[model samples]
Target: MMNSRNFLDLEEVRMEVFSGKISRAYCYVLVKQGKIKAIRVGRKILIPVNEAARLLAEGVN
Candidate 1:
């Protein structure tokens, strides 16, 4: 079973949360700046769906 705290891969994250267009460089910056959340599982960066949603909402407000 998938864990509750699992995160989505960058491509999936971009396609879904970013409306199918987001820069790779910008994502790295966000990760470095900690504006968005990221978890390192092995060699990949993943962002949780809920966290991404919350961040997007926070931006609008």
Candidate 2:
């Protein structure tokens, strides 16, 4: 099981990763496109911190 601390919500991703440049809708699109790996908990989308790091390392296209 993965700890909740290892995940980030779309808002955090936008703020921390993109510096608030991207919207949540765009993040959702990335999730739908498989560019960002996410797990759904109820209605909340949780993205793995490592995945965010990978995106940072690889650069989003």
List the candidate 2 regions with Cα displacement exceeding 4 Å. Answer: 1-4
Clashes of each: 0, 0
Error of 2 at 17 (Å): 0.6
Q: Summarize candidate 2's per-residue lDDT along 10-53 as a digit string, tens digits.
A: 88887888888988898899888988888999999998889888
* Candidate 1's TM-score: 0.70
The TM-score of candidate 2 is: 0.84
Clashing pairs for model 1 are: none
What's the TM-score of every candidate structure? Answer: 0.70, 0.84
Residue pairs that clash (backbone atoms under 3 angstroms), model 2 = none
Candidate 1 lDDT, 1-61, residue by residue in tens: 1356567786666666677566877777777788878888898998887777776567412
Best by lDDT: 2
lDDT of model number 1 = 0.70
